[model samples]
Target: MAPRKKKNASQIGSVSDNLPHNMGPVPEIIKSEIPAKALKEEPIDSPLPDSPVAKELVTPAKVTPETKKKAHKYKLNYEQSPFPDHPLPTPEVAEEVHRLLSKEHGQRKAPTKVPPPSATKSGCGEVPDLLDALLRTVLSANTSGVNSAAALQGLIQTFGAVNGSPNWHAVSQVKPEDITKAIHKGGLSVVKGKTIKNILSIIHAQNVERRDALLREKVTGEPAGVLATSHLTQIQKDAEIARIKENPLTMAWIFEIKKDSEIIDELLKLPGIGVKTASCCLLFNMQRPSFAVDTHVHRHCKWLGWVPLNATADQTFNHCDLRLPSHLKYGLHSLFIKHGKTCYKCRANTNPGSADWKKAKDCPIEHLVDRELTRKPRKRRRIEDSDESEGDSKVTSVKRKSSGSTVVKPTKKAAKITQSKPVKATPSRPLRASAVKARAQSSQVKDDSESEVEEVVSEYDE
Candidate 1:
């Protein structure tokens, strides 16, 4: 490498001076000498008035802090629901329904308050374990209370009970077929059994994971385990199992959630749990304020004009949950069920001329409902047979007589056949015994085939 000669100070100064003239003034290389706190305290520079950036820049308005929404302790508020707009029934209407139902079908007292998890005891008045309550609700789906109770009893009898509760863990271990047999009386035994089995399996799996995690933490003094070992003694394991049996399997974890929405969300993650099922658990089991719409509730709410005509049970629940007062939730739910079951006028699928309908008195809330929206009874027609003879040809007629007198004419094909061939006019005479017998046999065979087809159609309908 060659050594470079050093330039004079005057030459360097001359070059620097010429560079500025040729390419505008050179900007100073400023250093940030101010402390971080001082820089933070300094106001930010605004764009120059004549600059394009200034023209594009906008002065921001002073930002005020948003007020935080106060959360409800037990009830959920759906701020922006997708359901159609409709006002909920007035509190007076709800009260009236409750009062009327209480008179008709004995009054029921629902819990008015929900205790904290720490104070809650697993018993009649207190909230039940999540898993137990869920299982009972599942059995109650589309079934009468008596059948659901019977099914629960059968489960307790077969799998055995601990502290008056069925041993769900034992039930989980058995085959789904066994569960089906146990709950056969509840109806939809196969589907209910599978759903229950799936739920138990999921809960049991979660329990095993928790147990393993606890074991790992205790044995290794670390968050995770390095090796699988029987670190917990058999006695300790048995004690934990017994504790689970005494309490609900999911109670340890699920009850930790404080928000009603979170609890409902967690429940909705289960196999057979829907909005209605989850809400039922919240209202009845957790004693939380929730509107759970069943088929009966949905029908009644529609008739009452509280919800839109097209609203589904789930939509009704969501709409009513937010609109109805929290205090009335339990009472309204219980009363609605009672009224639907006992009141012939309000009951679903009630025929107009049925024994129950004929005996039922006027409904208490009949004036409140829109009678036009209710299902009307269908008009039945009476069928009659007629035989007419024209010359030697006999015509058989089957007529259906309704409220109005109208005779059924032959079909187009029959009419066309009659027009195509004209019968000869001849003197009428008594038919031979063999000919009459043959004709009778042919007619009987046709009636038998028609009856067979009608039977198949009815079976399919069922």
Candidate 2:
């Protein structure tokens, strides 16, 4: 193979000119928006720093080389792909959105906002109870924050051994129909109730399997159910610690994995868990850097042109999480939600006539998004009514002349164009009866002359 030639400066410049307008590294203007001073300051006081440089400097001593490789998988660049093409939002747009939104909503402090003690017990930087996170997130689906909270409260009130303790043990024993009646106020009670029961059943079954496996290895003589209480005094505590641990392996624990592939597979198998739900669990519960795409995020992503217009919520989630840096995921997710709710211009649809729409036209980020595609409802009017109709007139009725006298304006010439009657096309001239007969006689004479000429030629040839 021949060595490849290096491109000339002009050739490189021409190639770049052909690239999409948005395709390039993040612009300097966006970079300058987030100052070096601000980037250095940690939002929350912690052992580790959020800044990429600082994070590398203070890398955890326990993070093995294998863990480092696992982390690299999540840091994959999703913007460019060879096997399959996928569209993703540019870093500059994400940065711009973050900067503007953070100015309005403020940056999210690390040790992400925690739920109440009843909802969660994990301290800052620790993994949350997966079951609690799953149930709470499931309740949050397709409902307002207030309603989901109420539903969660109702479930605890009914199934919890005491008020604050979400006793999964007792919950596992409860009947499905009974669970349904308890969570009736959460909306989609039947579905949610069945989901909760199914999750509990899955956990219980997995726990039983783990216990049976422990018995086979250590407590060989004991029966399956009895192994839960079976004592293995002879075994070294360190030798059988992982296998003999009493806590059952549930889907929540499954999400603790560092590998994205395994975690995704296990999450999708559970009831009511989609890409959004799974990503949320990974971010909040597992303290991973996965980004979830809800309605607000999806709408903003589309408006920012980070995602294609027809991209689904799940596709947006995958595209974003894979491409976005780990540190920005949490803050950007919050900002997207905040901006989507507050920024009228970035909203999915807005009426042009609305006061909010008028105000949003001047938004700073207007140039960044597809401003022309702002959807507005067309005015309903009768076609039978002429444009000149005083009742149907859309513009201002008042007109002023140089003399300072106000007068009611008459309709323009264009207005009467629609009201004017349309003209019919003129008919073509028809051939008269005498003209037709004379034309036919001339044609016969011409044919007879041609036949005589042919006969004279044949006589000459003979």
Candidate 3:
């Protein structure tokens, strides 16, 4: 190719010079093809066009403040409990009902006053110690007062008392069977005895740990000359052991607990102490405003419509404690027990035909009783015997053989034989030609020999 000549910078036409200067405003068709707003970039603060494209491109709105939601109210203090709250009668109605029951049943002795805050002792009646109260309450469970008292007496006599209190340390040391023997009069002795023994063991273990901690603190505080052995002298050990025996085993630490719920929780951790038992201890022993629901209380509360018909004893207690006034708890519990026992109409298993029914022909709170909710005797199903049925000719009744010299045996069922399917035989491999020919030749030779022998015998006969 030939060498090209270079043009001067000014001589060459620019792109703008090459374009026709007469080009008018953009055609309407071309303007329609391109978006007017897209032709130029706008600041972010500017409002977007009211179109589908602009709608997608618009910035997300500032999140609006969340509206407040209503808080849910729990019926009982324990929100997680399975039982639901039942409609409670008015406090006035409850008070009036209590009055009527008190009048009819005769008021029980008022519960002992709560001990002063400074006082360390807290117990019910003659039972001066917390441990004694618990044991007495356990003995009284599911038994008559006389029987429970006798059982307690039996325990005292069998174990022998130290300083007028049952030697709990000695009881703890003995076998569970011995304790059962001691409290057999209580009924359910085996269970009660085991429970008592376990409670003692747990308390004894805790007490020992506490004593050791104290001893360690004492030993640390003492002068270096005073040996650890001196602090744990044989005499001191014997005296400590005697103290555990003579002193009614008391859980004084429990009294130190401030909250009633916490005290009940601690008591529940011990063996055989359920919500009812714990409540009993709280009300009668600790003199707290805790309402206990026993069989009598449970029955009366249901009849009075204080709790749902299907409510369990623990459920009854939870609802009643919350619903009933603090002052009424002690009186109501005492009145219910007394009325349930004495009132013929309300008492469990009351005989309608009995002469004693006259004593309580008219219940004190008959109008208050929820007749629908009151427990009724369950109707037993009448089982009709097949032999007793008439007009059944095909039916042969089976008679149970009487116990005698001849023994009746159960007949065995006949066994069924299952038919088996025949198995298909597999074909055998073909024999070799040489082996076959050899067998044939041997048979032919034998036949020829036999014929020759026959011929010779014929010749000899001729």
Best by TM-score: 1
Off by over 4 Å in 1: 1-77, 99-107, 112-127, 211-248, 352-359, 374-407, 411-414, 417-462
On TM-score, the stronger of 1 and 3 is 1
Off by over 4 Å in 2: 1-88, 112-127, 161-165, 218-252, 359-364, 371-384, 387-462
lDDT of 3 by residue, 235-352 (tens): 6644554564544354765665677877777777788777877788788767788778888888888878887777778878777787778888888988998888777677765544
Better of 1 and 3 by lDDT: 1
Off by over 4 Å in 3: 1-85, 107-126, 162-164, 214-248, 351-359, 377-462
Give the alpha carbon lDDT tens digit for every residue of 1-462 in model 1. 999999777545544554454773356668789855634577766656667776676863334558998754323346644353554566777777677767766677775654322111222223356677788778878877677777877788799876566788789889999999998987888999999999988877766676666666667666543122245554654455455555435554555466777778777767988888888877777777888888878888888888887676776887877777787787777788778877777777654544566788888887888635655433322222232223213232333232323244554455677799986655534433433443344344432232210101000000
What lDDT does the true structure give each of the candidates?
Answer: 0.64, 0.58, 0.62
**TM-score for each candidate, following the candidate numbering:** 0.59, 0.56, 0.56
lDDT of 1 at 294: 83
Q: Against the true structure, whose lDDT is highest?
A: 1
**Displacement of the residue 209 alpha carbon in candidate 2, Å:** 0.9
Please, what are the lDDT tens digits per residue for candidate 2 over residues 1-462?
Answer: 999999677545544455478574333444556557645765753333445655676453332334443332233333442213544555765777678767777886447554444542312112356676676677777777666667766767777733353666677788878877876776887898888889878866876665555557565654433222344343532234453354453443363245764576567678877777777777776767777788877776666777666667766776777667777898888777777667766655544434566767355566677644323323321211121345535542333233433344435543465358554545633433433343344344432132110101000000
lDDT of prediction 2: 0.58
The lDDT-based order of candidates, best leading, equals: 1, 3, 2
